[model samples]
Target: MSDWMVTQTPLPRRRPRALSPLREHLRDTFWFAPTAAMVGVFVVWLVAQELDAALVRSLRDDGDFDTLADLLRFADDAKTVVSAVGSAMMTFIGVVFSISLVAVQMASGQFTPRVVRLFVRSRITKATFAVFLATFVLTLLVLTSYDSGADPLVVASAPLVQSVLTLVMVALSLLLFVMYVNTTLRLMRVSHVIARIAAESFRVAALMPLPAQDGQAPALGPVTAWVAHEGQAGVLRDVHIARLVRVARKHGVVLRTVPRTGDFLVPGTPVLAVHGGQAPPRRALRYALSVGVERTFHQDLAFGLRQLSDIALRALSSAVNDPTTAVQALDRVVQILATLSRRPLDAVVHRDRRGTVRLVQPVPGWTELVDLGFTEIRACAARTPQVTRRMLAGLDDLLLLAPPDRREPLLRHRALLRQAVERSAPSPADRAFGLQPDRQGIG
Candidate 1:
């Protein structure tokens, strides 16, 4: 019944493989969505141009302009108006960007540097930018439709419709700019950033659910050759296990990886080793591995934990000393850890066609993960009673519903917290209070 309840159902069998770093990188970058919008708007502009021309030709043939005495004509004056609006829109865009960047920089300084990625990857911000740029682009393109020097009677002039559409675009851009400013301000708050990160982490945990481990990590005895990482160093975000299995099968050898996902692999670092046969072409093996500028949730599930933990540590540091933030981060960690408790961990035993074990890629187990999530923050915040008490409460909460396998580690971490409070609290009463499970201190 507790919020940290760890009881969970085993996940369905997953056919896991490496996520393409390039694909994920592009998705997170600022340009991808706007670039797509640009292409889409260009197509719309072309279609709108043709439709406007057709409307003008039809109106002229049917004497509609004569019938309407109040109709605004496409003239040199209209072109001048649109040109001015386009120039003004560009200027406003510059202002919006400048202000937004300042806000983002301030957030990074006050909150966490990684928080900036949220603003950069925001769909609303990207859409707002796209709308502003699209409107500017549309205004400029429609200017070419002007026939201020040519006779309206002979030229295909559709000034009234184009000008109206441009005005609509301007209105839409203004609305979007307002929305961007509001979103930017809302995201500046630390609570919103942490909540967003927590939400994303839970989504990732639920989507790429792990299964329970059957046993200890499988052993790959006597690898014949060690294969180091190639090229520039980055996080070894993912490795193609299927390819490794195939390589193992082809060589009648065993392949063993040196590090886990989320681990950095420097160039010339030993990443893999081939046993019982000649090593597979390092290039062929390297192609199956994905290295990225930083970690991602697609494969490095622990990276989310790491990011939140980093935020907590920074908040608890001497400079910031915000224990409330650390507690918030700890609770979110509990939420995901609870989710993981019910699911399985990645402990692979890849087999060849003959069903013989060919490769062993061991992912971090539950205990390793508990260490990853709590160890650093616990050390950093041992003296912060709010955080220590919250950690105790989190541990006790998870222990209640932790699966039979997880209870031990949860108890182990909880005891470590008790020891920390005992060692750091200034007095007996303070230690007693810090060890209490309630959010309120000394209660």
Candidate 2:
């Protein structure tokens, strides 16, 4: 029953695509690699210290170092052995940890590297601290177990315990990662929607073509001067067409015939019964005037569109918390979008089936309406769902008003409109109303 309820059941959510291999590699390289390396180095150092203690005690008990040189030589050998063993152990642990992390991410349905990167980018400082703390805790646990005296049971269980700890740490990391990633992505998507709306508004403003001040009036060949009487209706009471013709002949420009009053004169269309010799100044004036008029028309369209877009944007912003106001703003936006989409201002060129192209100038004021409409649609697209629904309803209204020929562009952009609607769901503030505003309002 709600206007927002285009469908009763919500559309099924699609599974997001997996991140590409290249993206995964880049994420790992940029975000994960440095932290992993640091942890690995620290772990190796701890292992080597433990190993050196064991070796040093053994060498001292054996009494193999009677001289300082010999003792130093033996110490060097012990250090090398400890370093090799520690390095290998650290490498093995790192590999296990990385594998567990990836597996947990895959299982949690957050396998995309884009998601991971989003998380990393959002909470770099927090995540960095987490990594440091995790490494320290893990190292303490390992050292504690080692110092507990290599009890057969404990030693045998060490690998399993390490694996379990790795899994737990990886799972925790992923949870935090996803939270940050989701938040970042949402913010980014919203920003993009807003920007798109703003751009459309500018496009509308560019439609106006105001005439330049430098423009000149077009020259008339075989010009005739006539005075009009007050309250006269197509009556040339005093001046005859023949007399006008004689005057035109006095000038080099000759009028073979005169057109009847009230004859329509289209731009660029030839007028009959007029010829001129050496009318360079007249030709120049005509060209300048034509260009100036075209420019003026375009400027007007642009200015109108800009104003319309601004109004829609302001209305949308205000409607955020107030349902009634929001609905009204949405309605206005829809009206503007529908008009713009239906009838664009300025001249649009289209090719016919015969492959010949011709410029089509829209009727006056049609351009301004269309520009305003498109701007409104764009602004609505970036808004919250409640606002979007109102916008969509407005669009539907405008569509109804549009001529058949103007519907194609709106239909073509249907997918984008749908996406905007989906993205712009009403916030908690919007849902306080019993019914969706659009559904409750006039169709």
Candidate 3:
């Protein structure tokens, strides 16, 4: 089977990236890993300073010196080279910092703004920055130790040793700079960006339970109270299902989310329904749910799909008029929809460790997921033959490859696509060709 064919099959549900909101935010930040690396560099430089000083003193004291003297470069030469390298490192670090910011901006503008988080959290960017900064620091510290007078007690070896290390780091930094540029370039491509988003959607799909299960959902009683949100208005990014379930079970009540992930949660809106009269503190429930200014893919599987679809829609717009980009986006969207087809599509019910359902959270059904993946692209492709043909082919491909349970949704979407093409095509022949389920849009 091909990659998508294999991917279309559902796997066992996997754990969520963050059981809570704090961890999720922490995962997206820029400085955490690089800061730790910078600290390590600082400590290493400190230790190396002492070692360099000790080596200098020992070599000077040995005085059996011709070999020792020749082995070490002059203090002035060492200082000059290290200083020059330090300036270069500083300049490069500035360039890297600027380039990173530009890359983030480009990614945000070209792809979805959510992708900015990916660039910021990139390890390569952080490592490259850390390496350059470390070299600068090492050189600066060694420059202070450059003493020309042979005090015998005073060791000039520290500068020489530090210079050698600085040279090695300079070479390493040069190599890493090439790799960093390549990574940045790859991130800019729409194909790679779409593929990455599709892969992430699959990974997140594993976080939810399969749509069909033998176990029944817990009985949801009349809403005893409505738990209103108490923060700045924003999108409900994700709900900690396990924690919500635990909280509900602990209080012997049932809870159902009023708004799903990606839904806007206003400050005074009822975010959840509490049954059995007793409700947990608004703070506790709020903590269990993450509210952010924008949606993220951590729990909202549909957000990634929406982003790719939006990209395709824009590409197909009259302003962009890039049907090829639209086709590229649709290709991944089809695979992503196929992958979601095998995953559980119904509302997710969270059961406790003993398997008693306590919380019911809704997700997009098969029809909704299919609409999200194809509706915009299909609409935008109405006037473009190549894109229209690809959309038809994508639907047909899914119809053939997706499992039986997923076929109904694909069929519905395929029907929608035919109707759209029939209505929007410029002529009778174009409409007829567009409605066909062939790759080239010919009847």
Which candidate tops lDDT?
3
Cα-based lDDT at residue 207, candidate 2: 35
Report the C-alpha lDDT of model 2 over 101-193, residue by residue, as the tens digit: 554354223211222323333344335334534544454544433322233322222222332344455456456545544544453442332
Ranking by TM-score: 3, 1, 2
Q: What's the true lDDT of residue 75 in model 1?
A: 44
Candidate 1 structure lDDT:
0.73
In order of appearance, the predictions have TM-scores of 0.81, 0.26, 0.83
- Over 4 Å off, model 3: 1-20, 53-77, 101-114, 154-165, 210-215, 240-246, 282-286, 401-409, 439-443
Instruction: For residues 94-143, write the lDDT of model 1, one tens digit per residue.
Output: 98789779988987887777677788777778888878787788788888
Q: Model 3 over residues 1-443: C-alpha lDDT tens digits?
A: 00111122344555555446666776667767667766777787777777777776677778746545554546566677787898888789889988888888887776667778667656788778878877887777777766665444444554555667778888989988999999888888878887778877877777775432443434576889888888788888888777898889888888888887899977888888888867887666757878888777777878878988888877877777777777788878888876665555557667777767688777777778887888777767777778878888888888876678668867777787778777887799878766655553433
Give per-residue lDDT, candidate 2, residue 310: 46
Better of 2 and 3 by lDDT: 3
Off by over 4 Å in 2: 1-303, 315-330, 333-372, 375-381, 424-443
Of candidates 3 and 1, the better by lDDT:
3
Q: How far off is model 3, as Cα RMSD? A: 5.0
| Candidates' C-alpha lDDT | 0.73, 0.38, 0.74
Model 3: which ten-residue window has the lowest total lDDT? Answer: 1-10
